[model samples]
Target: MQDPNTLCRRAVEYLEEYRDSQRHLRADGVGRSVGDVWKPPPNSIFKLNFDATVFVEAKRTRFGAIIRNDKGAVMAAMSTGGPPMSSSEEAELLAGRKAVEFATDVGFSELVIEGDNRNVMKALSSSLDDRSLLGNVVDDVRHLVYGMHWINFSCIRRGGNRVAHALVQHARNISEDVFWLEDSPPPALNALYQDSLLL
Candidate 1:
């Protein structure tokens, strides 16, 4: 058995090595092609970017989604909360599902769904069924996608999804699902404005 001091040293070394690898990856420009700018969907289609944040101590997860038209106008925004999830992937899956539901509720026939979770995006974009514990959630999202006239699934870097990311963090402060048609939380509005300027 290893002594406590040895274990502590090993943990510190592992963390240092992990940080170094990340720095090297960034410096080498490897495994990172996507830019941080938010891109709009094609003409006539709305883009839905969704994200989630977990609060383990509170045993709750918060989800947020923002819908914008091709012209970079905010169509709608939603923030909701649910039971705590065991993994960020699960939280992301739930956020994607919420985005779909919100789109359907708003009668959007065509759309593009975007998220920062690569695994969740891949599962939803693929034709093959997801057989993991989160399969049910993925299946439901797939069903929603099929119902739409046209739907595209895309993965984005967290930096590019600032508005939705901010909304998710804002969800923790609200009690119920809130929707904004013409207005949004200040942080999200600021993010939207910043992203719009890039268009």
Candidate 2:
């Protein structure tokens, strides 16, 4: 057996190494991207990218959400359908809320919530009371944020959110909600691979 003192020293060294890696990740920006590429979150933090598409012919909205770790590995992904939305912005807002709920359901507390819709992201990051038609949904998201230990809201270009977009497209064919834990469906796997190339 190893000496007790040696084991203690090794444990402390491992912890220091982990702390340094976390610092490095934070310094690099949690989820900030370079141009229009998807970026991973900092160590121990997950990034949830969400999107929504309006199926006007079906009179419904499809929401897609994908949660990935710092290594760009999908931890959880979901493609779900919702009631018809009058506007795209409203659909985006609802998708954001559903994404948050999905993350929490999967037991993630530290998250960087990302979306391609600027208007929805702006409303989510704002402290001012939203009095628009979708204000209630925005409030629901804010309430969910309070339950998280750490959370950040970010707006990225559509290119950076291709996986989620693909999932939304996949939702068009499925009749029921679909979820993948620690994995992604075929539609999103290609985009996931493309995004990881930059990582």
C-alpha TM-score for every candidate: 0.80, 0.82
Overall local distance difference test of candidate 1: 0.85
Lowest lDDT sum, 10 consecutive residues, model 1, at 25-34
TM-score of 1: 0.80
Q: How well does candidate 2 score on lDDT at residue 48?
A: 97
In the range 1-199, model 1's lDDT, one tens digit per residue, is: 9999999999999999998866664453344345677898999999999999889888899999988898888888888897778888888998899889888988887999999999999999999978899999999998887878998899899878999988988888888888888565665877876675566
Task: Please list the C-alpha lDDT of all candidates, in the order they appear.
Answer: 0.85, 0.91
Backbone atom clashes (below 3 Å) for every candidate: 0, 0
Least lDDT summed over 10 consecutive residues: which range in candidate 2? 24-33
Q: Return the lDDT, model 1, position 169.
A: 83
* Candidate 2 residue lDDT tens string, 70-96: 999889999999889889998999999
